[model samples]
Target: MDLNTTKSLVTSKTFWGAAVAVAASVAGLAGFTVSAADQITLVDQIDRLIAVAGAGYAIYGRVVANRKIG
Candidate 1:
């Protein structure tokens, strides 16, 4: 991606906010699972997807930085 796109993705508040939200959701899932077993299935699946996307976003910054350094 271009520099602007790289900067925007890495520095954007929305991106990091979503990452934090996903992490919190996953953390809550453990304690909430027993009570809401039915809904946990779908929510857990969605959380996994969001986590993957969030990981990719965070990694993009490192990959870009590595390219510049190496």
Candidate 2:
């Protein structure tokens, strides 16, 4: 696919919607887990999970979008 096609797909509602959904779910889970504890260890774990999930999504989108462009 060409750059135009890739841009079209990346900028589409579906792609954005999915990304947002994934991010939201990760955040929600992290928050829920953290809320159950007052210790720094649990909070750090939740933060780490959220960060990993967020990074994964970002990398995934970048790779997929680049593949489509190429």
Who wins the TM-score comparison? 2
Query: Against the unseen true structure, what C-alpha lDDT does each candidate score?
Result: 0.60, 0.57
lDDT of 2 by residue, 1-70 (tens): 4745554444345554555556656778788432223344444555566668779999889877845554
Model 2 worst lDDT window (10 residues): 33-42
TM-score of each: 0.36, 0.38
Using alpha carbons, what is the TM-score of model 1? 0.36
Q: Model 2 misses residue 32 by how many Å?
A: 18
RMSD of each: 11.4, 12.0
Stretches off by above 4 angstroms in model 2 are 1-38, 66-70
